[model samples]
Target: MTKKTVPVKPHRRSTPSPTPRPNPNKPKPGPKTVPVKPHRRKPPK
Candidate 1:
């Protein structure tokens, strides 16, 4: 999550990585998506 002070900073570019990536790197199930079970695609790690 560290990106060269401001180089790799997310900026206003885009935050469209929450769903596709599955965000397993966070070690915790982000938000309520884990219990909701709306994603029949990736199915967690």
Candidate 2:
């Protein structure tokens, strides 16, 4: 279910792509960043 979920997640995630991305990453590094690193460089499952 977890594996199947990651892709399904991006569906709802599609609309709020930029919304939630920075919301969480905001504290991680601030919204001043390029906003590509966290998504691309993240190693979490």
Off by over 4 Å in 1: 1-10, 18-45
Per-residue accuracy of model 1 over 1-45 as CA lDDT, tens digit each: 775565565659665655666565767655866554566667667
Clashes of each: 0, 0
C-alpha lDDT values of all predictions: 0.62, 0.56
Span of ten consecutive residues with least summed lDDT in model 1: 15-24
TM-score of each: 0.14, 0.14
What is the number of residue pairs that collide in model 2? 0
lDDT of 1: 0.62
Give Cα distance to truth, residue 5, candidate 2, Å.
Answer: 37
Clashing pairs in 1: none
> Following a full C-alpha superposition, what root-mean-square deviation does model 2 have from the true structure?
16.2
Residue pairs in collision within model 2:
none
